[model samples]
Target: MPGYGAPQNNGYGNYGNTGQGNGYGASQPYGYPSPAQPAITVGDGLSWAWSRITDNPVVLLVGFGLWTVLTGIGVEASYTVNGVEHSYGLGIPGGNIISLAAILIGPIALAHVGILTSSGRKASFRDVFTFPNFLQAFLAILLSRLAILIGTIFLIIPGIILGYLFSFVAYAAVERNLGVTAAMRYSMRLLSDNVGLLLPFALIGFLLYVAGAITVIGWIITGPLVALMTTYAYVRVQGRDVARYPSQG
Candidate 1:
């Protein structure tokens, strides 16, 4: 929290009063001041994410469970398609597509759960499918990934840089209901001003994910925790009081 700029009144006031009463209460307007805390370091981000996960095990776990089921189905479909392609010596399209769709959509749902949980609301598994701007969220995520993939093709560093720069696209799309292009632009703008703090946060998150992948079950915790952490960063960057939530302790 050290490097976050002075906490601006992003109109959300405290974390607890996210304007959930009105549909627009959950997020602040985009033009508010940047976060009051310093840019978040890796340790801070991890700690904050872990705390949220621990504090709201039921919410994160239920969300993760639903996500796991969908992912498992996608993996099964991919495997089945690969088998058919191998047997017939014919190309089968959309095998990887299934997996890609799962990857893109799963986070949007989980991020929604994280947003609700972090705001001190009780979230159910059904909340996973409740994104109001589904079309925009899907398109925004797809475009962001496409951009990153294109960047990686030319140079590894630019791709990695773009990945971090646009990391918040999904959050903005879901929470703020921004259009696909606007979400990407908003994420880039926020990161451009705070990459120094957020880059390490992203790196640490990557390391945690890798460690979790070593034991697939570990992701049940790490995955949602990382999502929650990212949500926390988004809130902080938007100048909300992340520490106001009991989970932040």
Candidate 2:
């Protein structure tokens, strides 16, 4: 696309979110094991799964869009690991340079998009990558990646687990204003409370990622789709009745 140093987030600028905090029972940052109790049934696997699915209807809808973006980006790159295995390439127009960069920058942009969902804001992938905010996102992603790297030292499975477990790191950075360690703790608490949902949702995320590969130009639409689904999941997990940001489309 644009040059290496091109800015990422100038597309949508601010989403005009005045919610800040304390509006609509959002004051308490840590509301795990919520006392208010939502209408959706949290009991029974079938009931719980259905509740989660329906509560976060945006997940399926948004996921479709995100998968396409991820797939398109993946397709643009060349998938190959050098003989030593230390080297990998995604084979996009930018070649290895952008590929390695995406490995680091992807999560940052993804986090911005995820946060936008939290506010119930609609944003393009281009919007998510907008300017200075991306720097914060990049930092948050780098911290999480470090944790995954630690897991890799132990074993491949451990690394995967670490990545999955810490998936919510973005939540802290984007929402609760938490640093890496705090964000990880926040994720752990949420995950512990809803292990079943977390596992399945993560699986769904992976499946969408894989599924998006069905087409080459899929990302233009899939990218937004994936972001939408993720935000839907977050809203559901937080026991939200309506999406954080109502859908404009």
The top-ranked prediction according to TM-score is 1
Model 2 misplaced regions, further than 4 Å: 1-94, 124-126, 131-136, 150-153, 214-223, 242-249
Error of 2 at 145 (Å): 1.8
Per residue, candidate 1 scores C-alpha lDDT tens digits across 14-111 of 43334333222343333354245555555666677777667767767777766765555434313346456422212335545666777788767776
Candidate 2, residue 236: how far the Cα is off, in Å = 2.4
User: TM-score of predicted model 1?
Assistant: 0.73
Model 2 lDDT per residue over 33-87, tens place? 3245344322322343333334444543354344334433443423456643343
TM per candidate: 0.73, 0.57
Model 1 ranges off by over 4 Å: 1-41, 72-95, 243-249
TM-score of 2: 0.57
lDDT of 2 at 247: 35
Candidate 1: C-alpha lDDT: 0.67
Q: Candidate 2: global Cα-lDDT?
A: 0.49
* lDDT on C-alpha atoms for all candidate structures: 0.67, 0.49
